[model samples]
Target: MKKLSSLGLLFLLILFLSGVSQIAFAAENPQYGGTLHLSNDADWDTLDPAYASGFDAGEMAVKFYDGLVRFDFSSNKIVADLAESWEVKNNNQNFIFHLRKGVKFHNGVEFTAQDVKYTFERLYDPEVASPGTWVYPMIKGTAAKLAGESAELAGVKVIDDYTIEFDLSEPFGLFLTHLTLPYGLIVNQSAVEKYGADFSQHPVGTGPFKFVEWEHDNKLVMKANQDYWAGRPYVDQVIYRVIPQPLTDIAEFEANNLDRTVVPEEERERWLNDPEWSDYITTIADLSTYYLALNSDFEPLDNPQVREAINYAIDSKTITDSLFPYYVAANDAIPEGMPGGSDLPIKADPEKAKQLLTEAGYPDGFELDIWVSDSSTSVRVGGVLQALLGRVGIQVNLIKNDWSVFYNTVKNGNAPAYYLSWWADYADPYNFLNALYTTDRIPFNNQEINSLLKEMTITTDTDQRIRLSQQIIKLADQVGDPYIYLYHTSTSYVKHPWVKGDLYHQMYTADKLLTWWIDQDLKAESTN
Candidate 1:
């Protein structure tokens, strides 16, 4: 009887070991199904890629749409998306793209070269009024299209059902980078015509996720596309909840209600010290620049001395210290680590600021209206600026508006002075210089700077392009002083350990939602 009992015990032990092995294997391998809960501080302005001007809209746009090419996170180089391959011809003035076969839009319509032609023509349509039109003006015949003289983009041609071509008016060295912008994303012509003006609400595209629903200020949900040209997303669904308050999002993350969230400035240290949470935290020095934009067309700001005084009044070092570890004080228009970025002689000198203000005919400091988004962080920064500018005799009247209103106001160059940040659309320094200092966006212009910018666009040599970028920055600083350079921002987020395959990219305009998945068993074990 004792021998029999020993044999039975051995059999039970073997079964136990087998169960343990199965569980271990499941934990290590990629799982196929789960949900990822994410948060956005505000509702996206629009899902229409053509008019998606803000970060919120961009976050959602890339998931539902795709462009001809996109930035590969691993290489930080342009890679094909819808297009299988492309060729630069005619001295870089003419280009051709070979589209992937059998790709279908969300509505089940097969994609073709015609769709590509329609997308670009719609973008150049005056009725669209896309802010991104500037990115493609180098295309031949855009002038006639913009003026309503032509309904078609004369430069864009459909070579066949599987191929398309673009003829540029000039050789734009950064043209591929231009195609990587969200605005360059392709759309189905039938979908746009069906939805008409309400297309923003009903977006259709050939991407990894399909739009399920958007509950206004509450949450936006997307489901994986089973027919995605690339394999379907690991997560079954992606939920982006609009939690405007940072603290609230953090609380949700801690309570296991969220998969990941941005760690608030006040909570960063605490999260880093926690044994369990610290492992989940990821940080990246973002390719973004935060600054105070003084409208050069507006009142005293039109005076360079006044702009210089405003720059001198703000103690950037102090501000950088207050947000220590999250931001680095910006010394030039370009973000640190980017090519051509350098620290100029600019620094905070209260005395110098006072002298400049006096020289600009505002000895006692004058009242100025500064516009900012209603986000808590923006408001806090605005208050800090108001205090600093007050020290140099500028009374700042803080005007806070929701992101949509604030984005439009500043984008239209209506705000006298505004606290804003420019996130990198592409890694090139010209992206920053051309977008911020050009007369098209900001009210400041110097013929020398403008000429250098135009030259930088076509300069193919990396070194020569960098040299031109630096020259433009120096000239803009000495002459235009269009913006008060503040600091470059960082991205920090604490994610649950079970949330896997996420990356904190330097240019994280779009999160790689398709690659991410949740380990349900591990999450349950950890939460419990």
Candidate 2:
């Protein structure tokens, strides 16, 4: 009997050890030769970053293109991406860049200075009609030609095969930051010469990922570029699916088929309470301002009292609470978290709104129409706003449009006192305030705004420039330029529990993909 018992005990102990080992292995971040999935609010149906105006397209661009300079998310300063280093001289009039020595385009051709010159010249070219054309006009003929008013770009010059130079027409603080944008992404002269119009369907760049193929409104695949100058990207593949509806995104993500998604406000509570959701719901206060852009140059918006009444009548807190409980209120036109962001003023006085309305000749209130996108976030807020304004005697007719179609229509300076939001493309306040308001030229700018923009652009002192920016925000408040004040919004995402690296918010227009990687079990173990 004693011998039998000893044999049984030995067997039990061996089984226990085997089970413990399995448990330890199961808790690790599993890495496989697989795809990392991401979903967006809508399908940004373009592969060419130059013509892809929306940020949705911008997000995928880091996988397909390279820029002259990249922003260091940690420092919010300029760093090298394609060009190894650069110097600003000629008394701040010229910027000369030295390209990386051995960078190769996907086509197997060496990337050179000619590509940089071509990028700027194309933006101003009549055929490209690039959305970023307005921001680069100082490069000489680029602006006038892009606006269809001229035929040549002036300031861009190729110093040599590895050197590129630009002469700024004036002291524009955000020019370098703008160059780091998707518009500034360099494509191989060889690739363009090879692909022609089909380049939109297929592109090659000195980026971390290379284009595989686009299956239309289904899937877009990008495989790791093994020969990447930075080093091979950690994820093997990145797959993007065109799940247009927000609910579809949530459903697909919950099914473990996707890695990340943009959660709209309507479903916020439901998703927050779900058992399947662990840490996946991501919410961050987007460095954006949600406000109504009044065509102050025309219509009811031209009336200062009309604009002020609309502003005062808005209960930014209530709408934000009912829809996005995770958001903050807008104190000014400029969003928070950038230089000079705090200088903007804040207040919500109904009496002040009423007084402005009365002074503008409408003691009995007025009728107005407001346009907004039909996404859950935009629609929910628009609904709440419509009701709020109704209470204050401003009967606003709300119009909801498709996102792309909506932007195209409203951007023509005919935007009908619509609800829209703006995010800064770079680190500086100049990018935030000046770009939209200073353009009193093409679409036309207000004289006051144009003059203020000129002063802000020329000022060299950092502190003085910030003060001038504050003055611009103050001026915007006094006038009803961007007429509505909604709440400041927040966004949060669940990051698969293993992804690591800098999640940059001010990535010009997109997040960096090169540094991000999955935590393979070999390196670290997961608690779950």
Candidate 3:
């Protein structure tokens, strides 16, 4: 009897120990070593930090590049990345950055202040012709370099191997934020010289991930930089698969092939309601604006009255509620939740629209072509607008083109009107105003608005800057009539249950991939 009791006790003890072990395993902190499977709708245009402008390329660049400053997604503050610290001197005209030591590029070259100088100089180099050149206009001597007056930027000076200085032409409040952009990402001078124009295909930088292979139109693979300054990333590798079809992406996510993908509009509700998928669906309010960009150079649209009529003809509420339930109807150019943003009353006024059309000498209606990318959402939106504009005696011919071709066409001012969205490169009102309204990217040009935008850049006072921003937005609306502010999008992504870490950011879409981890056991269970 004693032996039997001892044996039973031992069995119970073993069971308890096993249960404790299971609990411990479940509660343990994330373990590193799994590939994160991600998908994008399109292929990257370029990997070169200075010239990469599209979102797809920018996301990939984040993995392999480090900027002087970085925007912390959780805190929403500008924090040090390559530059450990910085100081604003000379009345905000001079910025002195103390670089972090022991950092190395993917190619094993030591990062120094000279690389920072080289990066900025290359941006100002007329030979490179980066569209991002507009980002560095405040850097002193940039104008001279662009005009062939100088070879080097006078403002960018290397104080030492670990310190660099930037002398601005004026006190630009958003200069630090600007440095956080992808354009400000530092590149190894030797690497650029080695690859030359082919550097876009083979990028090397001092980021958390190192470039491994880029199979164009298929996948761009990256491996973890074990010697990263911030500690190696949790994931072993990141595979960005190019899957253009939205439904196909969702299907792959369902099949456990893709760890992260955007939820298609048709399947969003189904996924939101499913108990299995409910926890994986994340909706993020994006700091972006979708609009119909009107070219003032295009006849009829050149008339402000006709633009106002087009804006009034479309029903924003219908579009937002029916087509894009995740989006918020926009009334003004500046999105809500930002400084200087307004929720002005903007509704479809057919009577006022008709009056404006008559005033613009289109009383009998007219035909116009509106260009859009071949994305399903863009096509649907265009179709809706076509129906609405037809009621107002305006025929809207929807012209769909491939993403790359459409972007190039619009950028070249070949499209009289285009459907597009402007995402914030940084969390600032200046980025929105300057990029959309002030740049030559849009045909609408107003001298007074331009002068106010210039003032907004230099204005430091929060209240004053807000006031100036609002004034600029109002002026653009009145004169330029550049865009019919449609709605603010809510970006939704479906993450597999095993994927851990925050993924949503106001300014950057891919920064979270650096810290994200995969639970091997859970991932295996899901797959099995």
Candidate 4:
């Protein structure tokens, strides 16, 4: 044989790895039957779709509920779920959905257009006070209903048993994408009536899996729905073990007691380098951003120079490098990989930050209290900020609280400064810009940016929408320095070799759990 050149050797290595990956993937032939053991640091707050907010609850919602449309991970597009097809007319203000035939809820209730109407009406109901109500402002008469002026939303209409229509007050381009979120998950009307306020405990929906049990801080169990329209789930059951500590979860995963769990930051590199464990790790850049939110209404933070100085004091890259190996430093409020996102020229400049503080009448710096959750990541980030801001002569006091208490304090605007992360509810720039900046939760505001955001929602032209989004981001970066952009997160999870399916989703983390299965032979070998 002729001597192979260096390039030929590299090509051969690539070919070998590619073939190995394919063989490894194909080895587990989509078998059915087995319980998937998973873990979460926090327990779910609620399983009711109307009130599901956190990642834990959202994960459960994905298995126990079905929305009109769902995001297709393969195509990265909005595809049909319960609603098989849809049509838009009247300049995007009107929408008609043709429901999938013979779909049944977990309780065997036939899914229909009436269920769709009921779900939205409940969302818009003032008494319900669902957090999901934010998603329905575009629908006609929703504002009036929310304000107690009307009892019904004039937009949702049951055209027939298998069809429904929506009339928006104006054109909203993200309407379809919004329907893919938990808020749009349809519920059986009878179940809601039967369960009432306790529906969160006894949730019923049309999905691949049905709720089996939830033992508060222990575990949540779900079983496959044999009558599911999509098809019966591959896994027979899913048990989410509530392990509060990441280290504990990792320990369980290593012991084979847990099928999958998040790999702790301390062990990430070691696991990646170990050939025995490398193939089990899966990492994906999450569509999310973390930031230090300054209550712009507060004294020092109200000053533009002070806000800018705070942004300049902390080095986001250094923080990410030390504390979060999987995260990328974010300079712009909008995360990277999204359209219209651009990085700001913000970096650590302690001297400039001090000068800006002096200019804002705080020559000796000022004392600021930062409220953060008790999560490992939050505590580390808070400690880093405390140290960095101290270098600029700012005295920082970190107040740590449980997740629920911390979230309530920040959401109520009681915290002068807080650390939080916003994950995209839908894959749209508007969700990031409008939800974080324009909302009353944060004190940032600019009439031009707000107007542009509103116009962007109505604008159908892609180029015009992109331009408007870019303008909004630029204006927010210049004026509304309410948040110090930190970093975008990359999430990693370790799965046993027997676990098989699409496990990563940019938006919905656990949505693909229904499709995952365990190889009987591989699992048996691991146990032996």
| lDDT agreement with native, every candidate | 0.82, 0.68, 0.81, 0.81
Compose the digit string of candidate 4's lDDT tens values, residues 307-338.
Answer: 88998898998898788765678776665555
Better of 2 and 3 by lDDT: 3
lDDT for 46 in candidate 4 is 96
Q: Cα deviation of 8 in candidate 4 (Å)?
A: 29
**Candidate 2 residues 109-177, lDDT tens each?**
888898888777776777876776766766766656676776545677888999988888875655677
- Compared with the true structure, the alpha-carbon lDDT of candidate 4 equals 0.81
The clash number for model 4 is 0
The alpha-carbon deviation from the true structure for residue 319 of candidate 1, after best TM-score superposition, in angstroms, is 1.8
Better of 1 and 2 by TM-score: 1
Q: Rank the candidates by TM-score, best first.
A: 4, 3, 1, 2
User: What shift in Å separates residue 509 of candidate 1 from its native position after superposition?
Assistant: 4.2
Off by over 4 Å in 3: 1-28, 147-149, 297-303, 358-363, 366-369, 373-375, 397-416, 441-443, 477-480, 509-512
**What does candidate 1's lDDT look like per residue over 1-528, in tens digits?**
011123223333433454564455457787878888999999887999899877678768889998899877443568888999999987678889999999999999999999999988988898888887877998988888888999999899999999999999988888888887778889999999999998999889998999999999999999999999988988999988999888998989889899988988787778878898878786555678888999877889888888888889988777777655557777777765567765476568999999998988899989999999998789988988999999988999999999999989888878999998877878888888877876454667678888998888776788898788778777777874878888876656899889876655555444547767788899889988
Q: Choose the strongest candidate by TM-score.
A: 4
RMSD of each: 11.1, 11.6, 10.8, 5.9
Please identify which of the two predictions, 1 or 3, would achieve the higher lDDT against the true structure. 1
